[model samples]
Target: MNTAPRRPVQLYRALLAAYPREFRGEYGAAMQQLFVDQYRRARTPGERTALWLRTLADTAMAAISEWLKAWRTAPPAARLVRAAGILFIIGGIFVPLAWWLGTLRPSFDYPYRYQPFVQDVLAPALFMAALTAFTGGAICLLLGMWPAANGHQRLALLSSALGSTASIVGWGALGLQLGDSWWSFAMGGLTLFFLGVLWAGLAADARNPLPHAPGAWVLAGLWIPVSALAGAVYEMVTGRWLDGPDWVFGLALMLTSLGMLWVGRGLAQMPVQAARAQDGGDA
Candidate 1:
């Protein structure tokens, strides 16, 4: 065999493929050069490994940034959008369907007399709403994943908006069963979560700065406990909280949860933006 040695330049060049194509196009050669320069300066394999790891971190950040930018900028094909729609539907259905199944089980009265709709229509309706929300959400998320799927991502966002709206409506209707009012702990939580998903989906395409709003933290902190507390309040005002006639208090508490979701959307966006910024800097 020839006595030639492998080149570090070649090694690092091969590693650049791990990055997204747009990123590679923008900075691949420069990164490879940096790797070569660092490798030339390092004396030990340990040092080389450390440098390579750092370079990899930088590359990953760049890839993620490129991915996000592409998600916002690209216009995806029709097929990709359709597939995303399917995934959203599947995920959405799982949520409400699971809840309905639990309700339908022989544990408690299925609210057949007081809330006839729960036993008959609402359960199926919720399940379908969940399916639609998820279908749309998934489409948005997947569309954001690839450059070719940009258009699909926008479509997915639209679907998510629709899904989120429908989810709010569904929660409102569910609240009515608990009371004539549209508020409950469960509904509140569901609404918040839906809003989070909707915002996450929207931000993917909007390129909005990650939500740094103070409201995000407040909502994140208060959403769950406040919901639970509403039950106590209901008990104090009325006799019981769990299965009561006046669900209006519960609805109020649940409505508060929407604030939490709105805030959470902001909180979630920050880290994503920071990560992208770091990646762009490295690239």
Candidate 2:
């Protein structure tokens, strides 16, 4: 047996890239050597497993701590953009989690089967947490995106901003015991948000020319409408006149999540005009 965990070592190397650049420059070689030594010394599979669990936890904490330190020291625009990006990624994580939580309601539909603590407290708490994080992310994104935008990007971002506001109002009204009518607002808001994102993706690509073929934005643009058309086609084939299969919505939701994630990543990595000005010695 080779005993050398090729995949784990590769993943660890990738995770190490998340650390601060200066920190890596100083400690990178030593850290990789230490991990290899520790892994090889573990005589049993269980020991290796325990080592990995500990390593993962420590890596996450240290990476976060290092990033926070960097954030504190970074320029104002960079700080804001990084914060927005992190918030967006967090929101993306929560979207599916929140959706999954909602699905649990039907599982415990009956009062006898349901626990009040879960329905009354846990679910609402989780949902509120998601809402807060996601809304904050959307607002921050608008702030970060506004600076470097051209006319088309500005227009798209304005649409996204409106979508964000509508979503907030919809979610807030629903929270306040408002009627089911608010759901329409919420749905409309999400549609606008997706549209704006797809539009922005195209505009941004035109400006920057993404390295990939056809581009990720194009995939998202194609998928959003295709998902709907696919759903309708399935509905027609299955003779479900009014609706399509559940997976239609699921597939769309998955694409939207991916699209949002990509958008956040791009925005986070984007050049801050202020930072660029400083580099160029322009006041």
lDDT of 1: 0.49
TM-score of 1: 0.28
Alpha-carbon error at 139 in model 2, in Å?
Answer: 2.2
Summarize candidate 1's per-residue lDDT along 1-283 as a digit string, tens digits: 1211257666667777665455677788676666666677778889888987887788778767765675564333322333343444354335435354435644366444645566446665665555455445444444433332245444544544454555566555764575545554344444444444444444443433224454543433344345556765788898886553434533433444344344433322323323343234321
lDDT of 2 by residue, 126-217 (tens): 65565465556556656655655567767876786687668778877887879988966865665565566567667754333221232555
**CA RMSD for every model?**
17.5, 5.6
lDDT of 1 at 30: 70
Q: Rate the local accuracy (lDDT) of all candidates.
A: 0.49, 0.63
